[model samples]
Target: MSRQHTSGDLRADRRYAYAEACLAEGDAAGAAEMAEQALDLAPRFAPAWLLLGRAREALHAAGGRETDLQGALRAYANALDLDPEDVLGSRLRLAQLGVGDALAAISPAYVRALFDGYAARFERHLVGELGYRGPTMLCASIDALAGAGRRFARVLDLGCGTGLMGATLEGRFDRLAGVDLSPAMLAKAEARGLYHRLVAGELTGFLAGEAAASADLVVAADVFIYLGDLRPALAAIARVLGPDGLAAFTVQSHDGAGIVIGPDGRYAHADAEVLAAADAAGLSLRSLTPAAIRRQNGLGVPGRIAVLSPGLA
Candidate 1:
């Protein structure tokens, strides 16, 4: 049974219904064509345009024509241009295509959109399909971080996807909060009942909203991979921590960007760059260990987990 949405828009909606039907049947070319036709009638329908682009892209991936990439990029860009309210995630798909300078032009917005879109099935695809052990492995590692002041009064799990980290910290803390950009992900987290509250927001902005000197333990597992540069998020994390606070997070160790890193569009960071970012944030690294990278596309890559504290701590 194919899932369906109940939006009554008549022509455009019916076109979308047909396109979706074709898509569910695995006819990417037919779906793309129908979606393009719908978009022609409703040029402002950003989702339709974006879906057309995706269908075309999927077709391209399955031995479709080389020209499909360019067409998909154009359709996605057009959708984004029409409605910049984050209604469509063509930006990230554009970034993944690597046809042009789409990455730099849309990496941040694309990542945000990508995460939001995947928020619903984020864990299922990542953990069940890709064998993502980031949270499972990270939770195990956090046990070792319990040193002299391991007891946390207030804990914050940044990018607490589906509350996996919070589950690990469950009973270990009195007050807990989670923040991420996707409500669907938060919905899953909320279902876990581990976090006291889950907020829909990005890292930098959410960190800004948090009161200073509140969180004693802040952990972000597999969150930093989407980020190309780490200085901004690091600074944000430093700002929200107590003087003796601790933060544990993960990072990918590859050379470039635009997917193909860990098979989940993960962007690996360099040691020098991470060190420099930490230094710039005035946070000293207590320990950085090269942990087992999560499996992606049925393979594993190198990764690291680090515990950091305020310079004064």
Candidate 2:
């Protein structure tokens, strides 16, 4: 951190600069080699960690070492931890890993904050680049429920990034509230002129704090993936629903009967698991439909939308 000038500093500088240039030109291994040489001369050169991160990423991207991806992330994380604001290093690692921009980033603290950052351009990147289907399909499923005359005077939109779901359901509800964890995404949703109120909080806890048995209809579009086990969330939803209250939700599904979290931290739940959770919560699954998130290369990933109502009702 001192930025001191030394006798061998000139040699170290040249090699470090060469490593970066090689990385920029797509020679990741060459860049890594140059960086090692520079580090040999100047053991404390912080910039070289960044160079090494990019090199390892390129190696990972080329499928040069799938087995080493975890190790690569650790190396990149070490560099970032040392220099929290290492822009180049952070950019390469997070971008290649594809963790920050998606729903996985949504949370209770203004859960929309991360989504809001991507809100202005969320749809474009989702549909065009990353093949996002959770949000759109969630909207569609909620609309179907409304069409079945499951209208409400008070509605809650959980994880309402940019108010997309609120916009789709506004016609069916006299009052609409959108709650999310990110302030940034809420800003965009607020600007959309859809929801009557916007709040920042975690999905289940926020839902729990509201006036008891208040919401007649609830829609959680693509929110369940963030939850590994659905029982806790399902229990909360049941609390907010009155005797006749109805809820519609979306969940990624696998072919079998279990739940698993992918490397992305998004949980994919099976039909039986989803059903069991609903049952345990004293809610009856009125409908379960197979759906596709979006299509890629003629194959669509499996997902489901479930409509639930309290069993005692």
Question: Which candidate achieves the best TM-score against the true structure?
Answer: 1
Question: Which digits, one per residue and each the tens of the lDDT, describe model 2 over residues 1-313?
Answer: 1121232588888887888789889998888788778878876665666567668778777876965465456556665565544432343345447634432232232223335456768778766765766655665665575564446799988888777677766567788998887677788888988788898877777887888789888888878876667898889888888787888888878876577654444567889999899988999888888877655456676789888988832
Q: What is the C-alpha local distance difference test score of each model?
A: 0.74, 0.71
Tell me model 1's lDDT, rounded to 2 decimals.
0.74
Clashes of 2: 11
Spell out the clash pairs found in candidate 1: none
Which consecutive 10 residues in model 2 have the weakest lDDT in total? 103-112
For candidate 2, give the lDDT: 0.71
> How far does residue 82 in candidate 1 sit from its true spot (Å)?
1.8
Model 1 — TM-score against the truth?
0.78
